[model samples]
Target chain A: MAHALTIHNLKAQIQDKPILNGINLEINSGEIHALMGPNGSGKSTLANVLMGSPEYTVTGGQITLDVQNLLEMQIHERAQAGIFLAFQYPVEIPGVTVGKFLKRALETKISGMNVSDYLKDLRTTMDFLEMDQDFINRYVNDGFSGGEKKRMEILQMLMLKPRFAILDETDSGLDIDALKIVARGVNRARGSGFGALIITHYQRLLDHIRPDFVHIMYNGKIITSGGEELVRQLEEKGYDWIKKEYNLIEEEAHEYSTN
Target chain B: MDDKGIVNTNKKSVLFDYQLNKTPKSSWSADIRKAAFQSYTQLSWPTPTDEQWRRTDITQVDIPGYNPFAIDGAHEIDVPDSVHALSLDNIMMRDTALFQSTAVPLIRKRVETATDIFEVYNLSFFNAGYFIYIPENATIQNEITIRYNFLGTHALASPHTIIIAGKNSSTDITIEHSINNNNVYIHGLTVFLHENAQCRVNIVQNISKASYFFSTGKVSLSSNAVLEYFEAHTGGSIAKTMLDAALDGSGSDAWLRGIYFGTGSQHFDLGTIQHHNANNAHSRSYYKGAASGTARTVYQGLIEVAEHAKKTDAYLTNKNLILGNTARSDSIPSLKIRNNDVRCSHGSTTGKLNKNQLFYLMSRGLSEKESEQILVQAFFEDVFSHVSGGTADKLRKIIREKISDV
Candidate 1:
């Protein structure tokens, strides 16, 4: 069966300041979409709001996972409904070992994951990620290097196998080798039943993963959507060409003045 | 006194003027009790104005309203034959000289110099007690457990426990305080570790929410002695404990860990002291707690290094988690260092559940309650790592119960 995550006229704010100004997008289970934007472009906010982060209030929006209303559900309920968000800065959980945390998460998701089978699956997944066997005993992301933290997030995504995943800058602070590892984790999860919205600022990550469609977001809204040529153009000319073409500087000034 | 050895007297009059009915006049404990009674008369119940009692108001404790329970009969306990685990009254009856030589002097000193009203009160009117002596150069493979269970209502259960670790000996002991509702469990304990002795002591206080519990104790370590002290306060409407570790000899080391989880209207006040009087002493203390449902938890710790104690290393860390909007936690860690060649530091953090951390867990498909429960369990993992065997299992069970209640 196929799943679709749809967002219609999504508008959100933090405290009283508006961030996501009517975000409209639709992602099917099979395709990978890359969301590119400059800093403070509401790309991350969109990802957070999709996962129902309490930090942001959705003043006007409707998010749905197939037939289920995502906005009406709690954060964890959305996750149980197969919506995963790979945090840009994953929070460190002290004293919780990777194996134990993953075991609990997998059990909560799958409900009937036997211990031996879970361990076997975990061992294989961790091996594919090149995580040391002892990594299972180590605390979750506590004192982990930047590259290692990114891999840990990808490791969780692979183990969870969510239907729709939003990678919020999962490629931000990674070297070439670490970047390849992350891309490999995501590629391994790609199939007719899995979809992802990869959010990043650079084209290097998209070069490795190869998104089918690219969307450029500026001033809290997607200004344009196109094919691989769009990513190539942005990589070559930067967001300035889009700003000039869309003529958004004067509108941005007015928006800031209203805020 | 009744035939059951229960004291029959006016509660208030007997609170001030108490007589020892079980012990002979010539017994060592009797003399100590008589001496403690004199000091008990000069003391009064702690008031809210007192600095230590300011956070926990005891003016409404109603100490005299509860009858003094006499648990002189057989207790529910099991131990090995090599260990000398006997009730204080039994020890005084069978071996009077042992009490006079070892425990009587210490009891006298604590009572005569007592500043807290509960300390002297426990000494003067204690109806139940125990004395465990680990022989010299002996290794006790099994853990020695002492269980004190209160069964009566409106009764004051005061018990004294004395543990003497002989030279070059090693052992682990657990003293549990379990009680019924509408009772007061006040206790005094002393542990003396001789030269080269290594001992681990676990004190678990789990009482009914309607009861009040108080514990006061001192642990003295001799040269080359090592002490691992673990305490868990997980019950009672109001619980207060004051335990001090005295490093009286060189090369002594003490590591202390404490944990408390409070719920409902429970209030817990825990006080700890690390006193280094000799050179080359090392001590570390870490205490963590969580509060929910309008509950409150307070941790007061002091690390004191004497003037003559050079090369003393001491550190203290306390962390608290408030699980409810109205829950509260207080952490006060202090240091009094007199020597210049010492290393000492202290830190404390009181906070609610980390929102980001919670969100991270919730994003992993755990419900809010399950996430908080896991976080609370992880919060005490460092301290919980120090204990093992039966005591650790019991602590984990209590933690699960407390977290589930929240």
Candidate 2:
């Protein structure tokens, strides 16, 4: 199977402090990859870099969506090029209705859909997500609850239907019912020609989505890659073992640098 | 004085006589005319040394030989289509008395009850304006629009409007002033709201580029009465407007919103007062101004909660957006609270547009110029929301058109 996204030797920094250090990963189509890491292990950093967030500087890296260079494009351009990022902390845009914003994004993406048919499609997606129809008319995430924000993100993803998506900690603060709903929504997008990078701290989300590959990220690098067993091991033991192992590797690198 | 100076002064007196002779006179018009001439003589034109006149240069306004024109019926008064666009009914101009018996008696009464300099001046030298009276317990659904257009050289136009909203009556009145010719114009408006009445007044001053405009409005609100006053100042070489309101009874409310946009060598000055004299009265004021080129604007707003007026709540704010290096704006908001239980606050902010907001909008596919226009429209949204009916939409269109030209 061909890969949908490829990140090679990605090294990123924030104000000269390394966050993502020479990380390499490839996500294939029709597959879900789980990126599990402890706190401050550059999990969110990698997601932001892939989404072309300006906060993180790419010191040395190459991120490609199929054959297109992702780094050369603007944020909205990246979004238009079929890269969707479900932010860990979504921004609130006041006075703009959710339906209007979704329609704008969709129009920018597809460029030719009729408004009435687009609205009908949106209503269908809202029904699938069990979202209140009134939410579509309300301001975009303005005064929305945490669960509503997460659900709205999923709703946008469904409306846009991007080829590659980065779900950055989408299950972090959701309730059990909300988590299940979110997992079900993600699984619905998991078939043919769709690829997702699910970045999370816990293995609970993996149980529902059942990723094809699990990767452990530490010190900005993917140290281990395996099947679902890696996620289970990280859930059982936590990231302490990986931290210890990376500390040894860092000591060895420092010794080599001094010599 | 020298012979040249005496000759010049005598010439001005002779000019005044000729102008007065050209005006038509009614039975009680002589008394009012005498009073106005006396008031104009007593109140001197504000000097540049005065704090209120510091920002507004009156050098060009010091024309000594320009005689005040009276309604001689020599010039045909053509009401512009823009005036009709306002769609105001029950309009009573200063001439409204000639046709209506009730309006004449009411004007006489208002002239008798007047005390302020502007009111006395208007009553004394008033030639024409609209006198709108919403009778007791009557509601006028349509807005009453009155237009005062000055169309000649050195035209001293004194137009007066007296609005009486009786108990339980409600109405909206829009007073629009425009000058097609380069001339001088002065006008005054006096409004009275009885117990439980509601009135919304929107005043627009769009004079000629080479004209001077001086306007004053006085309003009195009774128990449970409400007044929403809005003004848009966009023209004139020199313009000074004063709006004073007295909330005299319990449960009375007053809201004042204004916008002044100027360019070139224009000078605009505005003074507003919200006086709370009774308990439970509330007042709010928001005024925004934008200046470009060498245009200057001054906004002075006062909120006074009288003694023993308990539970009075008042707020006043003024914001200015300076678009040019030579453009300047002065905002002075004053609050006087006499009661211990009253709540009062005032704030003023002067700055250019936020670059971050512009960048954010531009990043979302809008051009930089388009982004600026959106931010400007958004900045005026809060002020526009207070405007109701088709007038608000019209004002929005006008603002958008003007911004695009910039």
DockQ of each: 0.75, 0.14
Chain A fold similarity by TM-score, each prediction: 0.96, 0.93
Candidate 1 positional error at A112, Å: 3.3
Query: Which candidate leads in DockQ?
Result: 1
TM-score of 2: 0.76
Report the lDDT tens digits of candidate 2 across residue range B32-62: 5555555555565667787766777676565
Worst 10 residues of 1 chain B by lDDT: B1-10
Q: After the best TM-score superposition of candidate 2, give how far the Cα of residue B143 lies from its true spot, in angstroms.
A: 4.0
i-RMSD values for every candidate model: 0.7, 4.3
